[model samples]
Target chain A: MKKSILITGGARSGKSALAERLALSRSGRAVYIATAEARDDEMRDRIAQHRARRGAGWTDHEAPLDLVGTLDATDGDAPRLVDCLTLWLTNLMLSGADWRAAGTALAEALPRQTAPVVLVTNEVGSGIVPDNRLAREFRDAAGWLNQTIATACDEVYLSVAGCPLKVKPDDVSL
Target chain B: MKKSILITGGARSGKSALAERLALSRSGRAVYIATAEARDDEMRDRIAQHRARRGAGWTDHEAPLDLVGTLDATDGDAPRLVDCLTLWLTNLMLSGADWRAAGTALAEALPRQTAPVVLVTNEVGSGIVPDNRLAREFRDAAGWLNQTIATACDEVYLSVAGCPLKVKPDDVSL
Candidate 1:
């Protein structure tokens, strides 16, 4: 089992479910770290749905901004699964925090984790180029963040229609 | 080499380049089918850049709507690479055409083609839910279309940062 794993895909592509499966694969009692903020009804509903879907055998933690610190605090006995990175990036950008430096710090922190960590992220740049500058910038940042974490992780997979497709370690002869 | 290949990825994620390489691998010449319309300066510049990057040894055909007809017309002596399906879907939707039927027709048309068909598509549904209904619908359609065509293809590869990672007929142990 890899110490660090990054799972990325488009929305509803089964990333969280796959991450849950992987998180609990090694140990049944893994931590579910959420980065999303329930700022709206839709977001609140989404958070609730995720919590409901991810039932039992898990401890919940919300780290809308302090993800690295949260990981540090939860690195004891259970493997930690960060539900996402894009939301964390969004929070940082919205708050005018240094997302790039935070990304680097998170990558630097992953290698030193005493417990295994599985992070989830989205593939936001695959669509038509956004007509808005902010959307464009956010997508670019998300893409860069995904690649950075992917590069630093021990394993990387792209989930498609609920199936895990390994992207890192280049097993395919493509 | 598979007769049909679907290479999907994000914007600037190296999908076109990978498709170009696959298009030229078996034979030196291939048909470059363009689904994008140069509606604005941004689009015009993007089309021009794609043309410049995919230099010599290719015949170009512009089919913003009549993709199937064009594919049928040019399925001789060389492989056909549809630059993208999402744009074609957009054209279809904008023109009030039935995209679902079009997608089904496309899936059926792939196995029947005498020459190989390499299709490129975007992953649009992986990001945070769009604020607009139309964007949401478009992303859902794009995602469904990708999965539909991917299921029909002989091979599917996800280009991440310009490197082709085999996805369809997945060889990964994960």
Candidate 2:
């Protein structure tokens, strides 16, 4: 049976770094699933920086949409790290994709995968209520998506100031 | 020595409720400190809703800018629950208050207070980098404030979907 880890934190909270560390800890071919699209210069630069930081040992897969499909296409034996669910949510929302359906599909597919998977997501619901409708909707959807993914994962961790705090496996000593 | 508790979470993540619950659990008078200023109808409604939810058994104190002064004026024996630090930060920013200086003052005052303090603060750093400079600045300031308060508090909790996960006292069993 494969293990699924959900790592959630704020921007620059070291969530992706933690996920990468976890993925590297596993013994197998590691694949980095990039959910962000370089839609603008800053985003493009961010993508470049992430790529440069990862350096040399992993296979990269881009899945701005059809995340479930991309995961399905990857070799089952390879350990996979999905860089983020937040960006994927944004992609879905911007592209007019059915977020609910996409979320459901991803949830269903996660358990069926043969490889150990580490997912990184942002915990965006802890901020002030956004004044704009789009931001508010995004926050709600992200929160719901996070809760759904967390429920499906074997272990869940919330990162703060680069520290990973185990939230799942609730019985485990903190 | 009086205890200080920091409750941090996303918007609608139940940080305030958790803070209130903790304050009520304590054996003493409870004072509610609200930092939000109703500049618009929607904000007014929100303030009204929060006020309605927290009815009776509590004295309400409004401190949009003078948080430290207001806190000082309150009865020192009463356990005070500050509804949030995010709004207070907003108030400070809008009023051109020096956030760094204000934060330092807060840090200094919290320890000297005789009353137990339960603070609610939003974790705004967990989301995507905001597009505008002001929003980005706000996120950074909020993050810094949270970290500062968390360090000072005897207990710090990160709430997610209404679940309170203890972050401070790093070694104790949860």
Candidate 3:
């Protein structure tokens, strides 16, 4: 049976780093899927820092929101780490896909994989509400995405200020 | 100034017909963004029909793929057509969204004001896809979404047999 883990938190909340640490502890090669698009200088710096942190022990895959394809491509001996799903969803929504179309796609794609997938995402809904319609739409999507992946995962963890709290997918459930 | 036209086609070859006829008479839209998620036998038939007949009105909106937000959602009265972008980008590839927080957000938000937006989307793209992985992904995203809005439209027409003959749209782009 295929197993998966979903890690979620807000920006600068150490979600990615926590996911990486968990992935490294697993007994297999680590595959990292980076989803953020460096559209500006700040993002560029962020991406660089992430790359440096990984430190050559990873095979990095660059797919903005094409997770299914990325997962398919990395189907081998490894514990797959999807650095983030929030940015990936943003890429897809901005790509002109309706939420229904986007949501069903991800939900259906998860069950077909054999490798253990560890996903990371931001908790955007934990703060102030967005004023624009699009931002609100994106926020809603992010929450739904976290729920969808969490349901499919063997473990679900939420990080806050650098601590990990297990939510679902208990050993008994597995 | 950049111009766009939205095309609505069917399984055999209806969408292109409508799109082409409409494009032949431009109505001053921004750019044509396709939003179909091709995933099944029906979708394959529809995509084949569209590819065989596509001409003129195909402008690439590669980035910010979501037509509703990426384009200028204005508060004025200028006609714009996002020809068949809904079907072209299909939702299978889409991944992040929360619909409860933004249910029918596009319908509520897009048609709210004076901007004349003509969107063309296939009534299909959701259903069975003969067990093919990628094809199934596509069909799951496309459904009767476009047909729902055709009723609210000032003019709606269906194409049967190959013909660009049936023409409809309020403001011509000539």
Q: Pick the candidate with the highest DockQ.
A: 1
By summed lDDT, the worst window of 10 consecutive residues in model 3 chain A runs over A165-174
In candidate 1, stretches whose alpha carbon ends up further than 4 angstroms from where it belongs are A1-122, A126-131, A137-165, B171-174
DockQ (C-alpha) of model 2? 0.20
User: Across residues B1-174, which tens digit of lDDT does each residue of candidate 1 receive?
Assistant: 679999998965668877888888887889999999999986798799899989999999999988889999999969899989989999999999999999988988888899999999987765667788899889888888999999999999887744468767865687
Candidate that beats the other on DockQ, 1 or 3, i.e. the better one: 1
What's the lDDT for candidate 3?
Answer: 0.57
Cα error, residue A23 of model 1, in Å, equals: 18
Off by over 4 Å in 3: A170-174, B1-174
Higher-scoring candidate on TM-score, 1 or 3: 1
For all candidates, state DockQ relative to the true structure: 0.22, 0.20, 0.01
> In model 1 chain B, where is the ten-residue run with the lowest total lDDT?
B159-168
TM-score of each: 0.61, 0.60, 0.48
Tens-digit lDDT track of model 1 for A1-174: 789999888789999999999999986779999999889999999999988988899998999999999999999968999989989999999999999999999999999899999999987786656878788878878877887787789888888899997877776553
Per-residue lDDT of candidate 2, residues A1-174 (tens digit): 238888987788888888888887766348999999888999999999888877766899999998898888984777899988999999998899999889988888888888888999987775545668788878878877887787788888888889988877664221
* lDDT, candidate 3, at A25: 72
Docking class of 1: incorrect
lDDT of 1 at A19: 97
Q: Whose lDDT is greatest here?
A: 1
Candidate that beats the other on TM-score, 1 or 2, i.e. the better one:
1
